[model samples]
Target chain A: MHFNNEELGQLEDRYRAKLINSLSGFKSANLIGTTDGKGNHNLAIVSSVFHIGANPPLVGMIMRPHTVTRDTLENILELGEYTINQVNADIWKQSHQTSARYEQLVSEFTEAGLTPEWLDGVKAPFVAESRLKYSLLLRESQTLEINGTVLVIGEINNVLVEDDVIANDGYIDIEALETVAVSGLDSYHVTNRLGRLSYAKPDKKPDVID
Target chain B: MHFNNEELGQLEDRYRAKLINSLSGFKSANLIGTTDGKGNHNLAIVSSVFHIGANPPLVGMIMRPHTVTRDTLENILELGEYTINQVNADIWKQSHQTSARYEQLVSEFTEAGLTPEWLDGVKAPFVAESRLKYSLLLRESQTLEINGTVLVIGEINNVLVEDDVIANDGYIDIEALETVAVSGLDSYHVTNRLGRLSYAKPDKKPDVID
Candidate 1:
């Protein structure tokens, strides 16, 4: 099937939204954890998290413009800190529930029956249930004029993970962590390792690690 | 284990890179196809692709700084068009091979053994083996001064997918398409659908869709 811009634009609003959303395929599923000055914590399931760079350990996420009240974005901008917690199979249901529009006073962690724990002195709370979690300090943000969406970039400030999940080479075995990948807005998935290959080289045929 | 900023900054370079890279969990793996004015096609596998918005149907990808001469980025900037093809389990090895630093004259499709099929007067070619592919017209480009990485944003111009893979609501069943997700830099993963939940509501308990 082929859908040109004309056909895509003609799709019903919700239909087109889903088509465009899921068309990109599986994305990293993480719960963005934030807290306001008053210690009001917010959690939202997001699929847009991607690596910006590794030297400063930066990650980037996208937020839709005025689509809904983005408490997570507001909190991050206010405090300049937030946490990214990988959603695993065990906590995916509760994680997805965080997407619900709750009153400003209500914390998604409390409403969804998930535990939020503060790491060291970090103001933002981390999902205690998540096996792999990291804290990031706001570094830069840019608004895309083409659309109302804002691109938020952050630098990793702290990280907490189970010791076994980290490979000697520094690769975290996400499958070992049982972290979920999301499609569109609602689907949750578990991934199986399909084999990790060696660094590609022009003359060498890539070798797959067992 | 807790890793603070000082600790993370002190780790071995390669180890830190892998740790930070894989921390985000599974990322959408796609082969970006582009062609220069001279009509030479280029393909490079990328995992930074993320949705910016669905209205104009924009997608954003991140390219590292001074990273080994990015031909795909150059081709898109030069011609203002490109295609994103999902990398599935069947072609993941070939897809990973595309990451090799090939000479500018070497086409990844030819070197990696994937077929590039030009579609409907579109300047860029689509991967013949990919079940889901889309062509995009450049909409915006911005360089993140924080890290010198470029954020390339494009609007969806054309999309092609297998017929049965799309659900009634417009969500593409990526698992049905056998799309593989990438972790860190070299790991490929196959995902299994856990469940698709309904839109969360403040009052209503979300239900799992059949």
Candidate 2:
């Protein structure tokens, strides 16, 4: 559509789109489980998870502004421990619903009808339904300037994956998890595999992808 | 599923995807169109496009570590101009096919069976089919350590869009464009409007979304 620069900016206000996706597409985790030092467990859906570094196996997520009221942010800051649970289509509705403004003490797990299973030593609980869950420890936290969001970097201290879902190599068969991507908001999408582009190996022919 | 450190690291090779998505998922762009420096155009897809800053609107793209050889890379470096095309489900197949390594200098438009239109002053062409296209000028190139790929950031000097798409606020209604998003590799996705999040306006409920 033809729009002058001025016209487009107005849409930002009329539309109320958060532009939270400024990061990248394909959000990995629907729920981030965190806790406070007092052991209060809080759950929230985090769609901004991104890989930061591989050497240390670091992953990061952009926690929306003022999520400080939640426990996940508290746990990471106070206990430096948390877990990421991949959300699949089966529970995406409940997962997205967790975003509703609930009291700080309200347990989203109970609110969403999800089972929170605690790992042996980990403080936070894992989404029992999640095929893949990572028990991570806080690595670093940075506040981004453009927006008032905290970039939580975590070290993969321990990982829990359903057998047969993970290929021997790191390639995860997300298809097995049936995890979907988050669109603007309140929308969930089931992702189907379209075939992978061959790794740009030194001598391989570049294949046409579907 | 329960796995220890040794086992998880073992599967890292395949299961651990790389962090090529520098797209904070926030202020990123979908490649909206592509054209030859001389004016012929081709429509392709990209989600890794990001902005370095606004003073000049510097944008960059992280070519996948798979398929798609250095042609587009060379083309941009040589001609110094290329249009980034956005993909909607309407042409998701054609846009998805551009990931292929076609004959060198073969117009992806012809291969994908799409058309390209030229801009008046720029060397590269824009995808005439795109709801939005930004004509960018090369700015700076930086090589990322992990992937060995150089991220080319450009300044958006001009843009092309169908007349009706723009609003008065200077923000483009991308949802109106029905843009498609890329997941790990081959998946083409249609996004549904959720609610938009905000940076400064944390108090207001996210009632409006694209």
Candidate 3:
């Protein structure tokens, strides 16, 4: 099938959303946990998280315009802290439930039946069910001029991971933790490893790394 | 295991890259195809692509600083057009090979042994072997101040997908197309889907859709 810009723009609203969302291919399933500085906690499932850089250990996630409820973004702005919890197979359903539009005072941790654990120095809460998670300090937030979406960049403050998942060379075996991937808007998937390839060099084809 | 910011900063550079990259969870594997508007074509595998919005069908990708050979970013800026091809099992090795720092003027397509296919009205070439792909026109480019990385935003110009892979509701069954996901920096994966869940509502738990 071929869809030009006009054809794509003519698609029904929800249909276009699903098609365009899935067009980006598989996405990381993660819950962004934040607190309003008081006691209200917020958790929202986001697939927009992407690694920005490694030296400063930066990460970026896209948030829809604040035209509607944007508790997670607002909390991060208010406190400059948030937690990104990997949504594993065991907690994918609960993580998805966090997307519901609960009132500002209502905590998604309670509404979604997930436990929120607070670590020392980090103001935000982490999902206790998540095997891999990290705390981040807000570094920058910029709104794209073309669209109203906000780009939230954060620097990693700390990382908490299950011991067994880390390989000797520092690669986290996410498949071992059953970290799920999201496709489209609501479909969840568990990944099967297809061997790691050696670093590419122009002189030779990459071989499978042991 | 827990790693605070200081400890994380002290780790070896390559190890930290692997750890920090993996921290974002699973990433989509896509080949960015671009041309310098001359004869030189460039292809590179990128896992940083993320959906920005649906109404305008915007997609964002992070490009590392131009300290090294950044043919993809340069070509996009020069021509304002590019193609994103979903990396599949059949061509993942070839896609990975494109990351090698091939000198300017050498086409990765020729080096990696994949065919570059052009369609009507789209200047960039799509991977002939890729079952799903799309063309994009550069909409905006911004250099992130926190990190030297550049955020490249593009508007979808067109999409080409395998006919059978799209469902009635506009969800593209990427698993059916054998689309692969990347982990850390080198590992590739194929996914096994859990059922799609219905949209969340505050009143009730979400049920599996279809």
TM-score, every prediction: 0.98, 0.65, 0.98
**For candidate 2, the TM-score of chain A alone relative to the native chain A:** 0.87
Higher TM-score: candidate 1 or 2?
A: 1
**Candidate 2 - CAPRI tier?**
incorrect
True contacts kept of each: 0.82, 0.16, 0.83
Instruction: Determine which window of 10 residues in candidate 2 chain B has minimal summed lDDT.
Output: B19-28
Q: Write the per-residue lDDT of candidate 2 for residues A101-185, one digit (tens) a residue.
A: 6777777777767888887888778888876677777766755443445656676766776667544434455654676665433
Candidate 3 per-residue lDDT over residues B36-151, each given as its tens digit: 88788988999999999998999999998573338788889989999999999999899999988888888999999999999998999899999999999999998888878899
Question: Candidate 2's residue-wise lDDT over B9-39, tens digit each?
Answer: 6644434443222112221225434444554
Better of 2 and 3 by lDDT: 3
Give Cα distance to truth, residue A111, candidate 1, Å. 0.6
Per-prediction DockQ scores? 0.87, 0.19, 0.89
Score candidate 1 by TM-score against the native: 0.98
For all candidates listed, what's the TM-score of chain B alone?
A: 0.97, 0.77, 0.97
Report how far residue B207 has shifted in candidate 3, in Å.
0.9
Candidate 1's displacement at residue B114, Å, is 0.6
Provide the lDDT at B2 for model 2: 66
